[model samples]
Target chain A: MSPGSGPHTAERRGRPRDSGTDSAIIETVLRLMEEGATIGALSIERIARETGVGKATVYRRWSGKDALLVDVMKSLEETAPPLKGESVRNDLVSCLEFARRRGLAKRSSAVLRNVLGQIHSNPGLWGQYQETVIATRREAMHEVLRRGVHTGEIRPGVDLDLLSDLFTGPLLARAVLRPDGSLEEGLQEGLSEQIVDTVLAGVAPPPVAGG
Target chain B: MSPGSGPHTAERRGRPRDSGTDSAIIETVLRLMEEGATIGALSIERIARETGVGKATVYRRWSGKDALLVDVMKSLEETAPPLKGESVRNDLVSCLEFARRRGLAKRSSAVLRNVLGQIHSNPGLWGQYQETVIATRREAMHEVLRRGVHTGEIRPGVDLDLLSDLFTGPLLARAVLRPDGSLEEGLQEGLSEQIVDTVLAGVAPPPVAGG
Candidate 1:
């Protein structure tokens, strides 16, 4: 083996990768996740049972629980359809509504919340999942904020990072804390509207309300 | 018991209710919590071993794990001291700092996150804990926002509930999602300042420089 060869090349020289079985396992995991089974509750045995695969086959692919779970999360991450629009408001609304519909679905929400809690305890899974799910969302929102800046709709000096947090952080906080796993009423209607207003108006005493 | 008896009269029926036993149990739980123990992980025997109280005593007070956990959460809720002073800025600053500290504490944050996960699976515990901790914080923040409206610090038309969510939600979201279990540095220093500016200015397009 050449010292300069990368891991990808190294793997290519070995036994051929089986994309079919890999995708099948990941699909099953995500489907079970959509059905409200978390990694904590649904063990390797359960997955084997549900997928009708031997335990050795599962263990052979993913080294352990964390690896398997990260793969599952990675597979689900791609399902968020890409945004398509020029309007910043439209972009934000589309992304938030997607999160609201997919992440907040009754079964998926429970499993995802459980996954989030587990991620805290398992650092590797947390890092991979956060970079994929949490960071991806922030980046998408940042692009919208950047567009607003270009259009002169938002103030130029506003901190983009903080603005992103201020925009999406509320939805996450409300979603995770809610007992019924639902966003607040009017959330869909007014989130971007209020955010735009606040970013423009500043939070000091309002100027005479145009009276 | 008379048909017309009032709660105030009933409150005086017993010796000051001690309230000390509650404190003892809560403190014990907090100590265990800081050590990264969960209710599912906590055993009556272990708590008994630590507190030097008989298992019977613990059971006599709390019916089981959920009941004890509810009280433990109640104790943690007390850590968020109520806001004082009349200035909207002071109230917000104090409240946000309190949440930032308490929610970001290494041990407390873990336990609370665990409890939130368990709450979904256990409905009875969810109702009580939410009312005690979540509702208490909401009410406290509600009062502060109300003051902001009256004192002309915040715009009158802003939705009090959404505004409260807006201000505190980011703190909670960052705490649970971030790997570091701490408030983001920018938020710790400038969240309150930015919020104060945004609430007064609104996120609408600014009319002038630094407006």
Candidate 2:
């Protein structure tokens, strides 16, 4: 059965179906991911069995494994509520806290590690990852940085791309490279503030004398 | 034939054997790595065959694939000479330049990417990589940061660990995550200096008034 044709046929005919099955499949995918299933190993049949849903239902929702995984990642992003802070520092800390919490979460870290392991070999997944994960987070960071620049909290002409990398790279490295290292605890607590402080020290304009 | 028991028995008993075979094997490993052979796929048998040497010879010098791959990484480190500069800023720039050059080198980046892709699954390799790659480079950065604090170039009491990550993490993320991205050329030229400058701006002590 083609995507959206099985369980959603009733919805197409005028009855709106509940979205629980959709979320259940994504949750199952995340759980399977935490249990060490990689993109290359994930199949609709397996997901269907694990989620206790019919294969036709899964097919009716996601076109394939790639689309399912993409939706799963997108759902992960949605878990972190939008960053809302009055100042750049507050916004950065909030954004970083979201990242830190996600990194420290057991399932999130496992899923991330699995993706990092296979991303090089999977271009379609990587493209989706870039779009859903990297680009979305980058846009949030860009907004914070631009606000900082406008308010004169950050220096003008700063390379936002490099600056964004500077801000997020350390945390990412910790999460990806040292997945089992002791630094994970450190990152979970105060490291985000330290990163923001240090980055701001560089990007923030010099303090006005006696003002 | 056992390792070192056949081809190098006479040399083991008498005069020192030429180091040519050692370098040849490493060179071939680098070449094969560039060709996309991972450490798991790079067996002594393959190295011996490709380098026109006996398995005993390859085994004699290195106990197994793990030791050989470790040595290959170690040799790459040796290519970038130790960082020495009169000041912390200069030292940082010099160190980053070394990394940039290595990242941009034809075979080096591919070898690194291959290692990164497989390192998490292979503890032996991951241990060796931590020691030979991460630890060595980190020590250099530590020295520079320490000297920067000592000379009042950098702010005292900075978290050197996180700061070190900030320095190298961006380049690493670019190399590993965006392997074929166009940012490579940008990295090879001025990005290193830019990183150093931005980081130093964050870490540098306030300028002394009229001094």
Candidate 3:
């Protein structure tokens, strides 16, 4: 094989060339949104102009606006780290701590916060977001609760769907419903542990009488 | 006094004179927001034009746009009913049930839902909304949880503020985060009972052992 034509150089040339363009395009969209450009009103021509790329360059990477938006959301949420196959308590804490960090990030980021705020205005965008991002995270939390039930850590006969919401609801309430207060530094730290321990204490099975 | 100048006639004349204009102005604002007019862009002149009223007519009712918006939001949410105060369980159910209806209303009414979606975009409007509508309801729910703790229905040593979020969060999650699913007929029915019972079971005190 020729040295210049080797796979290593081919790989190096291709990866950065594409990703740098991808992130630049993505950042431009987010910045536009933060500056109050509604997604419904933003067109590809405008985006390419902002990103200093030809419109054809964007079309080559993404088929359409919705497709590009899905990728943009993926950029916003880091791929979740794998859960430790530990006790349910530890696993649950890991799950909620992920949410805590995400909540904190939302508070700190104007672009992300504004982009998220815009999701509700466009039904198509919201549906795609739920399918791509929210559903996966929800299922992971549900799986943790199901495991807890199997191990007798959680009470049987309760709706795991609703039970999972109890665990997630408090954190989200602070995130969306009470956005102003989410910046409280004291409350965010250890919030995951507090949620897990408190809910587990409530749902634990009645002590086996004189066993 | 002349018969036409009596208090009853004067009161009737005054009541509808202001309120008819008030509600008409409020309705115009809501309709404008529903039609995709951003609160930040809407000026008194535009609102007056849309309402088919003189500019002075609007100023006669509200001091400014924010003040007008405050009244518009008030029109969207009906006055909350007094809680029965029969038991903490009953009160919590009452609290969540109100949220259920609210979620349902947001689903059915495009104007209310769209306006709420717009609230996150403008910080001043959101702050006023929180101060006027949200803070009152939140304090009421917190009081219910505190009473539960006092009466032994809720576990002591848990943060009541966070605990209240658990109750409110699931409903809001369905309402805002998972907007598509909130309309299911089955999920809406008995949701308040399900959430309250499920969370209560988790937070209940341990039974006395072999007493």
Comparing 1 with 2 on TM-score, the higher-scoring candidate is: 1
Residue-level lDDT tens digits of model 1 in A109-158? 55456566675457677777678777887787788778877876666777
Model 2 per-residue lDDT tens digits across residues A16-45: 665888889889988877665665557789
**Best by the DockQ measure:** 2
User: What DockQ does each listed candidate score?
Assistant: 0.33, 0.36, 0.35
Q: Where does the lowest 10-residue lDDT sum fall in candidate 2 chain B?
A: B1-10
Q: Model 3, range A48-166, lDDT digits (tens) per residue?
A: 88887777668878987767776777778777788886899999999888877777663223333434445544557667777776889899988888888898898898777777777
Across B1-211, the per-residue lDDT of candidate 3 in tens digits comes to 6442311222555553455666777787777665545454578998998878999877766677766766677677666789988799999988888777776663223443434445545567777677766788899988888888899998788777778887888887776566555635685677788878777877787666566
What share of the reference contacts survives in each candidate?
0.48, 0.51, 0.53
What value of lDDT does candidate 3 attain over all alpha carbons?
0.71
Cα displacement (Å) at residue A52, model 1: 3.2
Docking class of 1: acceptable
Model 2: per-residue lDDT, tens digit, B78-109? 54576666877888988887776676675766
Q: Where does model 3 exceed 4 Å of error? A: A1-19, A32-68, A107-121, A181-184, B1-18, B31-50, B53-67, B107-121, B181-184
lDDT of model 3 at residue B80? 73
In lDDT terms, how accurate is model 1?
0.66
lDDT of 1 by residue, B9-109 (tens): 34545546436655676677778766656566568878866775556557757888777787777666555666676677877878877777777666567
lDDT of 3 at A139: 93
